[model samples]
Target chain A: MGITRRSFLRRAAVVLAGVAAAGAGWSYLKGLAQSANEAPDQAASLPSAPVQQRTPQPHHWAFVVDTTKCIGCGKCVAACKEENNVPEDPHFNRTWVERYVIDEQGEAYVDSPDAGVHGFESWPVNSKYQNIQVVKSFFVSKLCNQCENPPCVQVCPVGATYKTEDGVILVNRSRCIGCRYCIQACPYGARFLDPNLRVADKCTWCYHRISKGMDPACVEVCPVGARMFGDPADPDSAVAKALRENRISVLKPNLGTRPQVFYIGLDQEVR
Target chain B: MQHLTRPVLLLLTVFLLLGAARWAIPRMFNQISFAIQDRTVPVGTLLGAGGHANVPQDIEAWKARQVQYAGPASCTQCHQESVAQWKVGDHAGVSCETCHGVASDHTANETPLPTETSSALCTLCHSTTLGRPSSFSQVKVHQHAGEATCASCHNPHNPGVQGLPTDLIRPKPSAPLVQHVVVAEANCTMCHGQGRLRPYPQDHAGWQSPGCLLCHETGPTPTLVGASATLGAPFAGLVQAPSVPHVTDGVPSCTRCHDSGAVRPFPQDHIGWSAGVCLLCHQAGPAPAVGGTAVGSPAAGGGGDAPRGVSISTISADGLPPLPHTVVGYTQCQDCHGSDQFRPFPSDHQGWEITECLLCHKSK
Candidate 1:
């Protein structure tokens, strides 16, 4: 039978609408399946393992770096290596010191030799910068900011990296796909791929040490008291007092990372 | 089956394929291992309720990781002596485990801990780097000491100090009792003269065979043990200078430590005095009458006449005897006042080097 033009057009339109609805439903289900892959269902199975005992008042851990006080001795870096079992390679520093040498001409020269493990002795090794008359020079120690609005946590596709109730960002090694997404997302460049573990690794502020009522290795070894760590929950804590009293600044204020690490004497040139 | 045409059958096949692909696609490509295991593995059977491997969220699991360093507090119980030494040293601020790695395992298993004593280890902190504060003691590793191990010259326990005075000289194994009956023609000075295999002490310059017999008995080596122990009194009689009361564990700088507002600051006359001059008169170990006797008194002087320039009537503010002569032009302090020199320095100065003369005895 010969079909009428009007009837033929109506049938084609109905078929196309049905196909579009099916496509949308299929994509929605696929998204759910992918999310199921990310959030591991094992949370309910493990009963014997001790979880962090939630206290009445959750701790808000904070770190303060006093650039004025840092001598660039690198004792913190050395101690971090011993405490964290960080690889001996110069490239794998969880925390490092950067020297900012600003000359009278308004040029900034920055260098971190061996991640400042051996200290800043013989710094400004570049012979070209040697003769430059410098107006200001100081050491700025850098570590994971453990940001409140951590881009790392937001970017982890597999829900592997998470922020704890106590405010430290930790990575679940089991679930990480080693995609390097979170590493790139970090604005402060704190994240790195752990060569040995094949996972995204960054500083946890020595989680093992901090949880047990001990200071982080870097904070413990700093002779000049350049690094400070404490719970802002406690009013009398040094970190809280410093944050309240000192003119504090963070690594990247414009990025809105809301970093828990505050710095005293932060220069405008520092990124 | 008869009613089914090519168009109708093809449409049914396409719908079935689309349904299958939607179900299988996630399982095939993505990490749906946990989702698959969630159904098969019963809660707490093989893969726990989470149906995944361990995650660091488990605080206990995270804590289970091996801890190497036990911290400084762990060593204090057994290593009291080293702790005490370190407390007084320039390295007092440094943690013991910084240099000594992974001590927790050692504490648990009694396994031997590695002690890094190489110069390279010292250079880790002490190498003259550009950024280190000038207040910290640092040096150019290559230029400071040519291939010399830091511990060779400086005591690692207290790096600021040098090796003890006793390390330089072995005590005189009291003269071999002559061993045989001496004849009238026997010449003791001839055999025991300077540069001889058994050289006599420089203090016995003019002593002849008879004078030696006064202190040494002519016999077949009398079996009197503990004779050297009793020699402390006689030795004090020979040298009237006061002895250092405290233990001198490689004490290189007496004034650097004692010159400050210490319990017993050095006297005014001793301001520019060097170590050689101090050692020339003062003995090691302890003074004979340190607690009770006054300076330069008969008892303090070991019941002997005070040496020239040292008088019983002259006492400085600290009650020590005043220097008899100006310390100027006495740069070669060991020449006239070294251990067993012409005038003979106290026995403690026996092994001291000429360079150590200025450490304590700076001339005004």
Candidate 2:
């Protein structure tokens, strides 16, 4: 039982390994404890979200755009950018207006220069587009669908992207990893990576404005009253009344997103 | 064996330290962006399983951030000339956003205010597209502008491309109309006296009337005034200008245009009641004879009773929904009507006189 040189070395090694393993184990346990505490806090906070949304109960806000009434003035696009302080880059738009032109042969052409932030001008004098003889032409505005079961929320690894109880899909800019999973998951191409903030950005339905009982910027500035916003659940709400009265369709309904934003006078060619 | 064990042990310790740093550092000092957003995002965001529960509050909070229409008043300081001009012309009542996009976009950045250079710009409100209301100032832009910008020929401020004649004595096929934007500064004769563009009062005779509205507000009917009224018929007061100096007795003095047998083509029902009929429906209270020679000189003993039942076009088909022909589109009622010209308003119509005409004179 007396100490030999080889056996002594082995004993010292085992002691060192034990000490190191314990230190590493302590940190691991600390992490687990913090996560465990956070989970309960998250759960508590999560349940309250839906509750708060319901408190304004029976008031599920929604939006509707009447394509027939839209005059392609670019007022909504300009208003959206000015309201949200979105960067000027065309690619970073939270909302935009697109024009469609169908030719005599039943061919459709679409273009949105600068998201139609500038009102669409007539074709240039004797340009190719003018000669094409557009049989049908119209304008349609595009924004975040704010789906009831949003894939953007589901794909957010950090729970950065989420839905408000009112059904507004919003992003926690701080929590987002900028991995762009939500952007990829959005079926409507509504999501974009804000280059300035380096986070995923999309339409908040003028969340800052709508919450205060004011219209979203886009709706406020539309000259023709084409873009409409209101609570769908409230029978008296404009969107609700419109939905009740008008034939409406949502973009990509087959995906089962249950979008809060609806469209009136939607043409078959609009995607 | 010792040499290998020492390196392996060091490597393991370093890996553990790295893992701890990764979890601990981020957990404590996650992107400050998160902190900022947490404060900004009103509660009830779709951050959870069922989404934002505080729908009422979160949406309420966010609503404040919604963008609003900065009206022409907002742009007055920056665009004095444009707004001032717009305030006066046919477009005076139109929203600046209707043509200029949003005010924020123009004011925030030096994004030059967009100029409307296309036919589409003017045609949005002016185009004679199908399904448009008859009261709207509809125009066949394809036939009119002919690939030219409406602003080129019309002044956006004062879109009086066709100065109307003050009197329309003849039967005009079409009346003079003004639109939002059109030939702004075209010369006087560009449309007025020109043969092709001239809007003659009578397309049938190719003759211009004295003025489209001089004799009457709208197209005249073949029936002379009160031709169908028999003895003692009630005559509703007329809206004619008071300057005509006509008598307001029981009988409507039709001498203004009724020249007895001199004027032919009376209403079918007026076959027997010639313009020469003397004091049949009226009392000779103290006025001149019917269709008398001297103007404003009525025979004595005027004002009589009602023919219990006579066939006179009811003072108008009033109390009925507005008819298509009476619409002027320029009526003061259209000011508050926006696109819905028929929107009911409080009896207290602000500045403009919502005349007796608008009660049934719907705009096109």
Candidate 3:
């Protein structure tokens, strides 16, 4: 049957519209798949990162921070930058150490000069500091908790920031609208807007490494073995053994975030 | 000419229409651009920039200020000696820029790094503050090397005492006592087994001062066989003095600790000698009188060291006594007096006016 001219025009328009829609859908699918592949290593997608293939493991990961064991070395802070391309601005830390200097008066004054990168070798440079003797000083290391009940995931305007199947909190940069609601929602102050990417960024618990059955860079390079990562479900794991024997606690437990990271010897002064 | 003229006129009319529209355009767009600037711009506008759209400067500078770190490997090329020493040094794991500050811009502009001579810098890691972890060494800044550059006495890379105090070293003749290395896993009951009589809470201040080393040093197992069980005067006299100056200088302000109360008052015997100056009458034993050779009188600065053949009293609290403020052994004031932490040595050899350690202690 011969088509009428008006009908032919209408049919041409419809075909063009279908083609455009199909092309758009295909491109989106390709990007999604690429992102999934890139999930094994956050920074590995970059040209300089060493190529590593992930081996899937059947377990939920957990991290432990023993405050007594932490030396305020700042090694983890430096390693995180190397592993995740974190910015050098000391203020934008993925993980940082807080040195709680409790004076003789029993008041704690916390400071993390340069996020303790070089270490507080000669702090209190002023002689006035000498007058106030330090009483109970210790270090508290902080990072994203990857909470089970993360407010960041719930408050996200779009599903751009969501939890992974393996219980990781992640932001899909492509989908992120940079609304910063997640930053506001995070209780740990772990989230920040990446100036370079203009998107919400935070500690991924080194998703790329964890997915590959490896420890995160911060845990890997800790000099004093203060930070530990392993499958908490396994009784044989170091983290599990530590948890079994010691009294551990999480920050802001009242918030009900159910943070996966636990702390050993958490002091009363620490938040 | 006729055909071209119609097309030209049509194009001119279109331009005229747009120009007129631009002049009379509603304020909605101005408000819309303002809104986009104040809020999230549509995806198309963000990507397109709308050419003249405003953006945060901090975000724009992220790319331009991207100075990649010049890792240790880069510094290794020029600072070969420092790199080599650092690999085996105390801070082996620390990156180069940590102590030197970020060197990426320095590499680009050959900027000088801050000196490591500042006492403050050294104290960041080495200060003898109270709450440090076990194995790390702590120092009272004033008593260290006085004002000398720390590198003068301690090789920063090698990290050992430089120019050994000739007087402090083990003397040539007496030297067979093995140093007991204390392991971390502690169980006091292992040595001082269960049963002990509850002695009266008698005050021992009236007794003679046996010097700082008498009660605070670790020594060979003491012979309680003939010795009195109580940790008082008779026992103090029986305690054998150390052959070397028991590093009392290392714990100068350690006096600050004892000075802060326990019921025990300063020994009455020390009263006639000098107040607060424990070293005047109570001297460290003679040079290390090792195996076989009997310990001699206290060196040139002798102050009637306890009788020879007698070992340092093996009293309570097991053999390991309370830690003396400073390292024990090396009693001669000159041995460490003008050095790090102890510089500005007392004109009269007494550690009296030292409330602030940094006043006397410079980097060295």
Candidate No. with top TM-score: 1
lDDT computed for candidate 1: 0.63
Candidate 1, B1-364: lDDT as tens digits: 3333444577679989976876786467453222331122122222223423334334443444444456677677689999998888766877776667557667655679879888776776688654445556778877767788887867676777433345633343764565434445445564357434463344444433223323332223222123322333333334333444333223344443344322243434444555445533333213222331222222323434333323211212233433433332334544445423334333455567886555345344
lDDT of each residue in B1-364, candidate 3, tens digit only: 5544565587679979976755554244542222222223234333432322221222222212222344455577578887887777666765565456445455555678674566555565566643456456667677655777666555465453333444534443654332233234422233223354222212223322233333344234432221112222222434343322222222334343334234332332222222223333233233333222222222332333342212322222222322222213334344334333433234452564453333234333
Q: Give the Å shift of residue A172 in candidate 3.
A: 1.8
Deviation of model 2 at B22, angstroms: 12
**Lowest-sum lDDT 10-residue window in model 1 chain B:** B37-46
* Candidate 2, residue A241: lDDT: 83
Q: Return the TM-score for candidate 2, rounded to 2 decimals.
A: 0.48
Please give the RMSD to the true structure for each candidate, in Å: 20.2, 17.7, 22.4
Q: Summing lDDT over every window of 10 consecutive residues in candidate 3 chain B, give the lowest-scoring window.
A: B54-63
lDDT of 1 by residue, A54-90 (tens): 2446688999998877877787888788878788888
Instruction: State the lDDT of candidate 2 residue by residue for B328-356, as single tens digits.
Output: 12233234442232343334456755564
After the best TM-score superposition of candidate 3, give how far the Cα of residue A115 lies from its true spot, in angstroms.
3.1
Off by over 4 Å in 2: A1-58, A122-128, A232-241, B1-364
Per model, the share of native interface contacts recovered reads 0.16, 0.14, 0.07
True contacts kept of 3: 0.07
Q: What is the DockQ ranking, best to worst?
A: 2, 1, 3
